[model samples]
Target: MLSWLAEQRIQEAMRNGEFADLPGHGKPLELEDLSGVPEELRMSFKIMKNAGILPEELTLRAECVTLEELLAACRNSGNANSSEQKSLESKLSLKRLRLQQLLRERGLENSSIFTEYGDQIRQRLSGQE
Candidate 1:
């Protein structure tokens, strides 16, 4: 009932030209590029972005960068135990895979980072142990 009343008021206002002469009245709305957002989450993410929130995939990408840094540190550390270093490397590889999956889900399968990480993983699997 309230929605009907509100819509009626909006229609009346439109009839009165209340929305006319507004900014961009004769122009098309400038829409943001949401091609990287998943179809189901696109609307939710738009609202979240309007409220100054980052999307989950972006946060996951940040985590991937941190993990990559930690893995590099382990690789360069003389005092790091081989087993511990290997564990961190494994975790980093898994995180990269997860990030790639997220990117693929969001229609970013062609993203450079995804391609790079995916290629690395494939190359590692194809190499002789």
Candidate 2:
């Protein structure tokens, strides 16, 4: 709805000579529901949170960057850089956020995955369980 409205506004502004260059109309995007993510992945999210991000804001979607990817992104620079570890922390944190987001949407998960993960999951979710 916002995208359509923005488009209309842009068109009107152009017709009225009220605008020459348009600011970003912004990319149209749908907020994905992460509630359906598998239990294992959510556990991974918890792992990320343990590393430091607030889980609630990130959501449980696996679409977020993974630990492996973070390592690679960090390594893209020829020389091994200490900053890579820090980047890993940020990625893990976001993944945890996704997990927390999913947990909230599901209204509290009682999956065995959490049981298996045990303390690690709890620690990451900020005592959300």
Candidate 3:
């Protein structure tokens, strides 16, 4: 009964052009790739994403990537200031350490598959891949 009423309302809104000017109205929706997330936790992950909250590990990983990019740019620049390069490198190292610690806490560090692909994971996270 409730669904029928909700659908009726939606249909009425469509007829009234209430949805016509909504963002991305004519375009295909950009779906998030949640294949890597476990099925049981997918809903929680989606809710957090919609709320603009990122998992801690992801935040740390992103920081590491940004720091690495900054470090690379510093190295490639004409000035090549040693102090600035060192600071960025230090921050990157800290972020990577925190990420590793988080993975270890989650028991992901010792998994056989993770062990095998650890280098690849690191490379990808560091934006090398």
Candidate 4:
């Protein structure tokens, strides 16, 4: 019964684009239609997607970094070849560094939040378990 409910929800989410999934591969979440979530929360999801989960085609190495770190990384990863992206990357690097420092200061650097960044990012940023 519960599984059926879960499946129904998944189907509904699929229709609504509220949830996205990859099967045996990384598929970019179609976040364009997602609504209700705050803008910052949505950004967190992008960070989660970039750092840990690569789009199935890219297959970037899996990472374990907080959403902030991922966001920072994404900002830094602004396609170096693109001048505009390079500028964004520079900004991201600075923000990423600051978050890293914050994590260290809070002593959460070595904690599960940092160690399990990818998973936590998925859960927290995506509002999923």
Candidate 5:
């Protein structure tokens, strides 16, 4: 069989020291920890990660976080402009809605995406002491 031939060839190479000068010859193979990823999409996720492309949910979530931070800063600043704060808040709300829709499509409709971000914006704004 092909595997047997491959094993024979590999043994012959080892006896001939073909692997001696290879990098990391004596070290353990560094295995990737992929326990968290679903079995079917692991390869796709790996390919996307290697190509520096984030999933839509992650990208949207990051935008939401940035908008939230900007809104918070605008509120805290003494000379905060109302128009800019309103625009940032609008953007944040839209992004959150998009993220929620994505979660729903992914069958996570019952779970709150904003919960990952802790208190909602209204709670933070109204509960300020």
Candidate 6:
């Protein structure tokens, strides 16, 4: 009953042009890949994402990427500033350590798949993939 009333309201709004000229009105929606997320948790993940929340592992990985980029810039610039490079290296190391601890807490650190391709997985998580 409520759905029917909602649909009628939506139809009335459409007829009134309330949905016209909206952003991305005619564009394809950019859907996120949820294959990695378990079916039972997909809706919760989507709701969190819509609310601008990210899982801690993802957040740590993003920080690692940014730190790596800064370190690369420091090295490639040929300035060879040891302090700045060391600082970035230290930060990257700490973030990686924290990420590893998180994965260990989740029991993924000892998984055979993770052990076999840990570097590759880290690279992918850091957006190198």
Model 3 agreement with the true structure over 55-103: per-residue lDDT tens digits: 7876776677678778889988999999888888888888888988998
Give candidate 5's whole-model lDDT: 0.74
Better of 3 and 5 by lDDT: 3
Model 6, residue 129: distance off in Å is 5.8
* Candidate 5: tens digits of C-alpha lDDT, residues 1-129: 999999999999999999999999899998876554456657986899889997787677667767887888998999999999999989988998998898789765464543432234334344442
Per-residue lDDT of 30 in model 5: 87
Clashing pairs for model 2 are 55-97, 58-98, 59-97, 59-98, 60-98
Q: What is the C-alpha local distance difference test score of each model?
A: 0.70, 0.58, 0.78, 0.51, 0.74, 0.79
Which ranges of candidate 5 are over 4 A from the true structure?
A: 1-41, 110-129
Which order, best to worst by TM-score? 6, 3, 5, 1, 4, 2
Q: Model 3: number of clashes?
A: 0
Per-residue lDDT tens digits for candidate 4, residues 1-129, read 999999999999889866445463455555453343334445765676778854321121122223335555556764534655556556656655665675567565666534454344346544475
lDDT of 6 by residue, 53-81 (tens): 98777678778878888898999996779
Stretches > 4 Å off in candidate 2: 1-65, 72-79, 113-129
lDDT comparison, 4 vs 6, better candidate? 6
Candidates sorted on lDDT, descending: 6, 3, 5, 1, 2, 4
**Model 1, position 125: C-alpha lDDT score:** 45
Model 1 per-residue lDDT tens digits across residues 10-56:
99999999999899998999988666444566788789989999766
Whole-model lDDT, candidate 4? 0.51
Give TM-scores for every candidate, taking all chains together and pairing residue i with residue i: 0.45, 0.29, 0.67, 0.32, 0.58, 0.67
Candidate 3 positional error at 114, Å = 7.6
- Report how far off residue 75 is in candidate 6 (Å): 2.1
Off by over 4 Å in 4: 1-81, 122-129
**In model 3, what lDDT does residue 45 have?**
69
RMSD, candidate 5, Å:
7.4
Best by lDDT: 6
